[model samples]
Target: MKKIILIWFFMMFSMIFSETNSIYNTKIDMKRYPNASVVTLLDRESIIFNKDNSYIIKKHIIKRILNYKGKKASSEYKIKFDKRFEKVDIINAKTVKISKSGIKEIAVDKSKNIRIIDAPSDVGLMKYAAHKMEVIAFPAVNEGDIIDIEYTIKNNKKQKISGTVNFASREAVYNKVEIINIPKDMNFNITKFNWNTKMEYMDNIAKDRKIIKFSEKFMPQILDESNIPESLKFMPTVIFTNYNNWAEYRDELLGKFIKINKSKENLQILKEIKEKVLDKLITKDMTNMKKEEIIQDFIAKHIEIKYIDNLLDFEASSPKEILTRGYGTSLDIENLFLLLLKEEGISGEIVILGSDKLVWDDVKKGIDMNRFNYAISKVTIDNKDYFVDATNEFSKLGESVIENNIGLILDTGKPEFVNVKSIEKNITRIEKSYNIKIDLNGDALINKTIYFYGINAIGEREKYKYMTPIMKQQDYQKELGMISQNAYPISKQMDVELGSPVKISYTYKYTNFASIDGDFIYFDLPYRLDMLDLFENVRKYPFELVSDILRKNNISIEYPANYKVRIAPKSLEIKEKNMLIKRDLKIGNSNGGNKIILDTVVRYNSHIYTIEEYSKLYKILEKLNYPKNAKVLLEKE
Candidate 1:
């Protein structure tokens, strides 16, 4: 009996499928109730198969147009089916009907092989209603069978209106499906779109309003053995306008302005202002004071900067306001400085730049614009160029602010291209000497003096913020100990200080080196320490090729008294071009005591060397650690 009932249901569905070409129009009235109203329209779709295992889809579109507008809206709808069947189901029909005070729902049966029409709530029903009519058809296969689908849309309204009917089906099985032999007054638009053929790849389509069509051949998984029987799933996306247009729209809404350059006139005004400002600030009576000194003093006394505020409207304030406020952001100070320099007859341009820490390799490709962050000023003095950033309180006048490296400079007067020059790594060297007396009782008294000189000193001081208190002390001790292995005996009497190039001088005493094994006197020669250890284990990766490194060191040793040396005396000499190490020792006695002297130096031209070159240089230093004369022996009576 069940089989008979199923067969009868299939026959009835097939009959409806044969009439798939029938089109229906629906009108929705939204004013039936005080709060809301509704109306529904239904349609049938089918796929007809031939004996040759080929099939075609016949789409019948029924639209339920809703005209609704109110402070609040409500409605309910229901749809019924005689029997359930596979490949013949509602695309969007689910859930039981409910009051639409908010969004309600409609229910669908699960026993039917309907792929869609299972709306959990009223929102789904409304979405089904809003969908265009052309997407209502089912895909067809090569096998001979008829598919019948019925669906309805409801809207709460009383208005009377008419809507056009349209239908769509896959072109793979059915080459073309359209409303043929229609009236000439009907208007329509046909557009072609493309889809990604790759499987498992998410393709984002519909960034703009366009319909995409996919071929069955493009999706092999959806095809059957003969490549004729299969099902394809396509996403239904609508055509929407571009969203980026709103940015330009907002700009246009605000207003536009043209920039005019009065170069000659502006230059004269700038020159007059510079002279007046400098004359009042600089104490030098003569016009020929050193530029570095004048700029340094001016920056130290006048330039005041405050943390930038989001609400700050001006990009730059006037020089008078900057001086009065004593604080501004990079943009504010740089612009003000440029104005002052221009007033002083100096040709300066504002350069836009990315912060030093911000890498620009990819950003230069122009994917996005937010990569840029900081700015500075470039001044040409007597044909010499100098870059300045007044934003940094500690930065010197001629010093390139570390954060402003490689930043793009925007020139308002003339858009001339300006490049930021790279900074050379700072190298410092300290040399020290110790004089002491060693008695037969294995007791020694020592006095030590040290001298520091290099760019490394300034770099170390600049990095003080990154070091903990204990780490800083340890670092300082390690640095001082480099002059001599017995650094604990040395007390730092004077701290490091900066002058033109920066210098540090200190003195200390050691009482621990009094014990000796021989009656005559003996001492092990200090090993030569290479500054190249600073570059150890650094070039482990390919991307570290261009990073720069700084190296600095100080060494000191006391001359032994009444000493017998078996190895030759050792000495190292480092100059701008090459480094040389030589060791030779001989036993000797002096008026004060036995004396032994060891010297070594590893001279490098500059700290700025590429990773490849640095690796090569490091190899040379590694060779200096040869086991030659690593140990020395002395005799005593």
Candidate 2:
């Protein structure tokens, strides 16, 4: 009788789940995405808004694991939100394992393996916002198991923010379903981002409420690439907004700032900062540009910018609080910088900004004020405008991080979209000079001097300024491993000054720098030209070059006595509209030995390239990276 009941129960279970295209009945084919360790069988999210400005969101996710690596999908679950406006509740969760003989199920137990963390996991965050996260781990998870998660978030207050739902993840999904319900009379708009395929959607009127559903099937995973903008900017997503438009949003944001700027406490703090920090920087002989540079440098270095917020504090930090504490969130830092500039007689306004990736095709298609997650100050000088962000410690007076290029100026009360290009035209330049002395045994002593300009200088200065000499040497050893295995730094020096390119000079020795074959000797070229070729993989999506870069390398090699160069690669030069690469090799006589001087230069003019462009660049790289062609041969006289 017991066996009969067990069999009947499973039969009923299978029958109920075996409906057409139901997630519980779906079977993932392991061969479909061979590189993928797991697949999302279903991801459904539903939002129901009430008449009282509160809403409830239900999320259901089902994933099928294919291997041990796939277990990460079920190993842990985390949901983060602002505690002031949202509350999360786990409805029910379970994991099922099916084998040839039978099936086993395990349900989540909130009494064990669950934790609530109040602080952000990111170490860089310094804001004291009331943010919280609930984390849970599924039990009895293993390879080839299917995990299902169900949860709901209830809104506690009126919705001041828009919503965006992403259908793509690191794992492929067979089906994705999203639904939203609102009052029939509410005005709203939905925008699509990075959408490649069409989705089936339906609008229905159910009594006094309106319902919309969107469904898509067989969506592949978005491959992660370095240097590219984040997934939020380009992934397949649905953006729903009920706040009307950018103008309304900008007015509300700037209105708050204006009120704060008028506060007596805020004014006092600005006056104090000007007296203590700005007065010393202003010299009668200094130009306006110099004073601006000094003011920006002092704040960026002295005032720390961290992402610190609490659950109850969702608003941007007040200027007075930020100035008093000497540390604040990135937004706070930018707001404070704007106020400081105002005190210095510089006329500027805060500009809302978006990532460059968000403006790939056009700004209108993906335009959503919610996408503008950054703030910077823009000042016009002599009819020219300059944008800067104090949040970025290395940012210069007229330059900011490249990602924050697409901007909307909030100055005139009416927001106007602007393409905020860098005023610093020559952004990054690297110059490296090496003097090499080679012995008959093929060992070499090298004295190298490296110079960095613009962004490159700022980056190198920030990286080494705080590091100990021993730590810095250890870092160089790892970085130099590509050039020589036995490279060791002998002496090092750094020259960092305001308004000048940073220079790092060091001397190093390399054992067995050249290979010898009987009477013949060979030396490897010391410079690497193509930075993009380092990845070696052709990405499915567009790769970001980020910025214009110029790299120059000069090597002076003095070989041992009585040694003459037998062979050398032909000098090469290639130039295109977007890039330039050149290699020059000159041989001369020095100190009774053969002297070789090699110079290589590579310049990139653009920040983005299509896959087709990258393919062409790769072809050029093949010609430049030809190992046999890069060798310098030497023979006894």
Top model by TM-score, which number?
2
Q: List TM-score per model, in order.
A: 0.43, 0.84
User: What are the runs in model 1 whose C-alpha is more than 4 Å off?
Assistant: 1-277, 283-292, 300-314, 342-346, 355-362, 366-369, 412-492, 513-515, 519-547, 550-558, 564-637
Give lDDT tens digits, candidate 2, residues 1-637: 9999999999988885674225655766657666788788888899988766578989988888777877865578888876767889998777877777666779988888678887465445545546688987888888878888889999877754576677666778898999989898877677776666476778999989999888888775776666555554556777786766677677666665676778887788778877876887786677666766777777787777664422113466676677667877655677777677677666776776664633544434534555676667787666678877766666565554553267767765555777665655536677899999988888889887777676666677678767886887677677667566788666663333433466666677888899888888898877666665437557676666656777899999999778788788668888887889988989999867779998988998755667787778877877677787678888887
Candidate 1 weakest lDDT stretch, 10 residues: 224-233
lDDT of 1: 0.38
Per-residue lDDT of 1-637 in model 1, one digit per residue for the tens? 9999999999999886454323111122233221222122333233222222133334433222223421011112223221111123344433221123432233334343233344233222221222222122222211211222344333222111111112222211221122211112222122222224431211223433222222221111121111111011122111111112222222221121111123465445445555776667644443321443355356545765543211112233444445566755555566656565544455666565542322333223222223234556777766766666655434443445542245454533322334454233222344554455455554445554444333334353465534676775676677657745654534544344444334444444443344456454344333555544444634522222112322332223334544455554354443333333333333345665665544444343322344465566566556655555444444562
Candidate 2 C-alpha error for residue 47, in Å: 2.2
